[model samples]
Target: MEVCFVVGRNGAGKSQYLIDQAKGNNQDSLYLCNTVHDRSQELKTSKRFSVKNTGSHPNNVMKSVIKKMMREGTHRLHQIEKILLYCGYASHITVTMRAGKIDSRLDDFSDTSSIKKLTEMIDNYFNGEDEISFNVNFGETSDISSLSKLENLLHQEKPLRHYGMVKAIEISLYKNNGEPVPLLNASSGELSLMTSLIFVLGEISGTNMILIDEPENSLHPRWQREYTSMLCSLIEYHEVKVIIATHSPLIVTGAQLDERVSSSIYHPATGNLEFSSSTNIEELLWGQFEIISPKSRFLSEKLAEKLEELSAHKVSLNQSIEFIDSASKASFDDGQQDIFIAARQLADSIARG
Candidate 1:
């Protein structure tokens, strides 16, 4: 799989470029974008091109994936676990068979007993239920059995289906301490990123081109740093080309470490695309994104004004340097205090002149 990152600022036409790619490409493609109701409905009508409206109510996507898992099989266990681990907000997960109220935690089943507790529970209580619903809960100690293991253990009494038919699913979340985390809270950047992966892994395959716009949206700085690599690791085996659009420097750094990944910068003003060959984050941020000063913009602006004051003799060079030093210790500097060092150099140059 080839992963290309489209790096640019907001209003850069990155999303529009993705839409155009889907429209122009002959191959089957999936465009994942922010949901604009009328726009999404119109795009959904295309046959070869599939559109997923994300960003607005992303939990709906996860609910659909969970329901699909219940209907199909539990083979997606590894994928689900990986997402939970990556998100780091929860430690474990519980999936309840909502209709039958059957909770299958593998720990509840013992090796000494030939039959598991869940199978016994189903046989004794949930038999003859026509429809089943699975409720997913995070942070609960739920060691769900794999489909094969469950089938082997349950087959002694009856086929797994004899208990109930798969129908619907509800998803819940919690903190590591087992306190419930609201569903709305779970629909954060972590969930958004996980939802994108689940959507792609669950539905996309077979040489499809995947277009994901701003996967870094609302992600923490740490998550942004890990997002690209995490995504590439999951989808590497699939025969697909992925194009992700983002303005995050942390995301750009991830692509730099991977040899297989490629990137380009979209100049929204000129409508030009520049292929990015540099592996350095500083260079990429400055050269490609035109972010000449990758420092706190407010701090940078303040420093610039102070430099102007120094040039105008309103402040001495030492006073300017002291000002820079003071600003360096100030809050909202965003770890780019090195701007002070540069300002000190400029002040020294002014003094020499």
Candidate 2:
């Protein structure tokens, strides 16, 4: 009721959809999409929503914008040009006029401030001083009264101040007596996942539209699919709406493969994104994606080099130096050429990517 996922592939317009949805005709709610408001070409007609990427790079607009700027010279900003496209790991965030303002914690996506490049921004505001006034805490509860330290400080009538929250994350706890045990140390995957949780936890007003782009970043295969289910559950139980842009089959599977979940997906094509729906979200995501033609697949350079060496060395392999010598070997020219062509193609393709 409150949330709907705008699912699609990279560059397939998921971000634009969220912006438009957030900016509904009345435009009375807060909107957040880190950088899309500023980086997207649809900025003006985009209905003007607020967005932010907690894991933003020290730079703005993601790398794609930078590359475009380098090429386009002084073109209108993506937010203005409607040419903004996603590049992996871009920091973005925006917000438009909201009724009164929603919870602010929805911005957490990764260890953004910890990035050295971000230090300057966090320290100095537009006024060139540490004018920041907000709490970045490890606790999830909006009311600080529940936190031990915050409680103590409030009881003592002392000031409560927050510098920044670091790489804190969520973990499933197995109760040992009364205390909770951590699942494991953090990995990049865990960081990405926890950040997503942190983002949603902040904005959970029940029956709100929550959107995400590429919710599969940095997660393991298991986490990838589970994360999709997690988002779906959030939408269903809380009456929230969600939209996502992604390239992961695991995530696409979440929508298409899960009977318990309702989802839709989009893929990139020549002009626009092609859209599809599946009650079986998982099956759809895990669609029969196999190499139909073995030759169509590329090999790694290491494998190719090994093949080339073997092919050039004639009598297969032997303990004798006579059979294994590279320069001194007299081998079949045809087989050597064949291996060389395949290996070269593989090497070149890999290099291009």
Candidate 3:
């Protein structure tokens, strides 16, 4: 299981490349998306193709192609390799694309007794009228439109019992009377946390490679740290291959806070993959108070502009103030103010030269 992150700017062709790889070589590929009607998740919606030599016939809907895939066969060895594609999809569907291959038939995937039990389970769930409810422990919302109340809620010390679009979830756990909790009660960050926690726990238990993209999207900086810590713990305990893609500075900062995470982010630049940061990048990113430091390439251009301005023969107090303000805003470290002060004091030297 080789887990890797492929990151680039939007429209960088990264997702298309990954899709092609999944299409070319995979028994099953699961694509989970949060948005409905997203074009990215558009793949084979039906399982048939048609052509006409010449005729007035409009063509058929190809329901048989779809039905064949839906119909399960009997042998484990003869079982069709499934490609599970999902987008804004809660239900799972498996598909197989074979080119007139007749050997792809099944007759013994399970024993008669096992098949009977499976059939019973499916029929009972799908055809039966009776239902069973599970107990859910979500609390009620007190403030729906009060800003002050919402602000105060944000200050809560403990994690919400069940948060973020939770009420909207298909929770088996419900009240005795069967009313579920409402989704509005949870904040975006709370929902993000809940989803991450559930996903890490529920899925990826037996996955070959687990991939998370821009996981810091809806999370607060603090929760980013918390989630990173939780992920580290899970990866260690499970010994699974994990890869995360993020453009958040907070994610990098969070990983730097922990001693266990070692992988770095790689981004595609000009069709060549560039290493944005290894484990060593952050340690060297914020170091050195001096602008002349070798690692301070990003700040070098700004520093040069400041220095060139100071070397002129006509400088003033107002100019000094503006320079200091700009430098402070573009600060690399604590010594930023000191550099501005140095320029201010040397105004006479600059004016003389």
lDDT of the candidates, in the order given: 0.57, 0.37, 0.37
Pull out the clashing pairs in model 1.
none
Residue-by-residue lDDT tens digits, candidate 2, 203-313: 344324555555665678776756656655544556455556555555554454566654544433322333444323332332322111112112223244454555555
User: Which segments of model 3 are wrong by more than 4 Å?
Assistant: 1-8, 13-184, 271-353
User: Which ten contiguous residues of candidate 2 have the minimum total lDDT?
Assistant: 81-90
For residues 210-230, could you state the per-residue lDDT of candidate 3 as single tens digits?
445456666776666555665
Better of 1 and 2 by TM-score: 1
Worst 10 residues of 3 by lDDT: 78-87
lDDT of 3 at 152: 24
Candidate 1 vs. true structure, TM-score: 0.60
RMSD of each: 10.3, 19.0, 17.3
Per-residue lDDT for 284-345 in model 1, tens only?
56445443333444456667888999889999888888777766554333557666677788
In candidate 1, residue 273 scores what lDDT? Answer: 60
Per-candidate clashes, comma-separated = 0, 52, 6
